[model samples]
Target: MNALIFPGQGSQKLNMMKDFYDEYPQAREVMHRACDVLNFDLKGLIFGNDEHELTKTYNAQPALLTTSMMVFEVIKSKGINFDVVAGHSLGEYSALVAAGVLSFDDAIRAVRLRGELMENAVPSGAGSMMAILGLSPEKIEEIVGNLNGVYIANYNSPLQTVVSGEVTALLSAVDIFKNAGAKRVVQLNVSGPFHSPLMAPAKEKLSEFINKIEFRRPNVPVVFNVTGKVAGTLEEMRMNLINQLTSPVRWTESVKTMDEMCVNKYIEVGSGNVLCGLVKKIVNAEVYSTDSIDEMDKLEGVVKNAEIAEF
Candidate 1:
């Protein structure tokens, strides 16, 4: 089986989809629609906007959504079928959109507002995130327990977990983890601490927004970030999405669950090969990214080969 995966923030780069936008008229139209919906020059931002402008939370969120959706639309127009879909963090919204649980408009609006809420949830410089490498989630949690206000935010893999919370708490935890044989503990450059109690305000606000929106049953099972389980109902998916703001992203667990379900091929459907690299680390499979037209062609070839093997 094939699992379609999407990337989160921090994977974007300038000129990410320039080739596709130039080559595919449909992609260009979708990009234009996104710019109008967002009331900003999204196409310009991805290709010509300054680096600093592209990094803003509000812009990054919607930009990624547009790019991911554009790629999905291209693939879907070709009549592809995916057994299941999953995404990391912000990519969850993209997965939801692809799964048909949320419309493209609603997903874009929700994510834009989500980014704002997360950015404003905590006072500037009060909280932060740090990546702890070379340690299991359990060991990271053990260290988190020793720190006052730090919490595991993104359980990325067996050897990678991002901790978030009060800066003091994170710093202290980093110190102990380094002494305990961690390979590296690097602080992230982020506006606020995400996926922790620091995001409670954001969670509250996003929950209200989510309740006001309509959710439909997904076309394909989406492994949720909060639960790492396939959600079959709109209500369950909505609650899981709302809770995701304040809960750690169980990405590693989700990958493992997909593998157990026989999803051996994972195609990342957006910018950068970050998720592709992680899939390589987590499981033995063919990982592909749809970042460029060439990559997209490569992915289609892989899918065709998979079909041939099945026959």
Candidate 2:
């Protein structure tokens, strides 16, 4: 079987979908609609030269979603499909659109608000996130067990776990993890503490917005972040999305679950290969990324061979 995955934050770059936006009418239509929905120069923000503005949380969320959906639209035009789909963090919104659970316009609008809420959830510099490498989840949990305000935010891979919390607690935990034999601990450049208890406010605020938008059952299963399981119903999917704001992303477990389901191929259809790298660490499967035109051309052959092999 084959699974399609989408990337989240930390994957955005200026001119990520410039080629598609300039060459394909479908991609250009999606970008135009996104700009109309957000009432901002999303096209310029994404394909323009201003890297600083494009990196902001609010801009990055919608921009990445637009790019991913543009790629998905292009892929769909080729008559390709998948057995299941999954996404990391902000990428989940894109996955929903691909699965027909949410319309592209609704997702674009929702993510814009979601980003704003998350960015303003806590005061700037008051909270932070750090990637702890070369440490087991259990060992990292043991070290963070007694630490106040610090919590695991992302179970990225066996060797990479991210922790988020107050700035002071994160700084203290960094030293403790390094002393406890961590290979490296690096702080992430983010606006707020995401996927942790500190995002409760964002969750509460986003709930109102989510309640207003309509959600439909996915045509294909979507491995969610909160439980690392497929949401069996629309209500379950909705609740999982709500809880995802304040819950650690079980990316490692999600990939493992996909493997257990006999998915032998993973195709990342987004802006970067970040998820491709993480999925490689978790599963021994054929991984491909389709972020650019050249990569998309290569994916056609990969998909055809995988289909012939009955993967």
Candidate 3:
């Protein structure tokens, strides 16, 4: 089996899905729907807007979702399919859409509301997220445990982990980790600290919003970030998505779990190569990524070869 993974934030770029939008009328229609649902000209921002403005959490959330969906439409149009799917952080929603568990309209609206809520999750400057390289997430957790505050936010990969909480507590923990022989510590440029208790406000609001929306079982199971396991039921999917805001993203665990399930190839159906690079490190398996129909065509032979090898 193979898993098709989606990337999260820090993977977006200007005009990221322009190729798809240009090639497919359906892809353009998706963008039009997003613009109507958002009441903002996302097409303009995505195609041509100020770089810094689009980086805002509110804009980034929807932008990433639309782009991922654009690429997804292109691939599905080509008849490419997957056995399982998973995504990192915000990308989880993209995975859900890809799996046919959520409609584009609902997903777009939910993420729009989600972004606005997350923007106010914590008071600006009250909390932050820091990336610590060259240390296991467990080691980082140990350091956070011994500190006054702060906590693990994202277990991105084996070597990259993020810690979030009060800035003071986080900085102090960073000092301790740095002194303890960590290779590097970098602060992220985010308004609110996510994937930590700092996002309680966002979680509360999102829960209410989620309850109003409808979700169905996915065509294929998705490995959730919060649980690091496959979500098989609608209730489980809802609960996991509700908790995802304030829960650490178990990316490494999810990737490994897919590998253990015999997922030997990974196809990233979205903007960046970040997830593909991480998969290469985690499983040492064949990985593919595409941003356009033309690019996706190149993978047809590769997927075919992999299927033959399995047989």
How close is every model to the real structure, measured as TM-score?
0.97, 0.97, 0.95
What is the TM-score of candidate 2? Answer: 0.97
lDDT ranking, best first: 2, 1, 3
Tens digits of per-residue lDDT for model 2, 1-311:
77989999899999897888877899989999998988899987787899888888988999999999999998898777788999999999998999999999889988999999999999998998999999999999999898999999999999999999999989877789998899999999998889999999999999888878889878888999999988888888888888999999999999999998999889898798999999999989989898889888898987787679976
> What digit string (tens of lDDT, one per residue) describes model 3 on residues 102-140?
888888888888888988877778888899999877788
C-alpha root-mean-square deviation, candidate 1: 1.2
TM-score of 3: 0.95
lDDT per model, in order? 0.87, 0.91, 0.85
RMSD of 3: 1.7
Candidate 1 wrong stretches, greater than 4 Å = none
Compared with the true structure, the alpha-carbon lDDT of candidate 3 equals 0.85
Q: For candidate 1, what is the lDDT? A: 0.87
Candidate 3, residue 171: the lDDT equals 76
The parts of candidate 3 lying over 4 Å away from their true place are: 292-294, 304-311
lDDT (Cα, tens digit) per residue for candidate 1, span 1-311: 88889898888779888887888777887799888777878888889859888887777888898898888888887766798999999999999999889988888889889988987899889999999889888887887887779888998988888998998777767669998889999999887899998899899989999999989888888999999999867889999999999999999889988999999779888898889888877878778788888888987887787689989
| Residue pairs in candidate 2 whose N, alpha carbon or C atoms collide under 3 angstroms | 1-311
Position 107, candidate 3: lDDT: 87
List the candidate 2 regions with Cα displacement exceeding 4 Å: 308-311
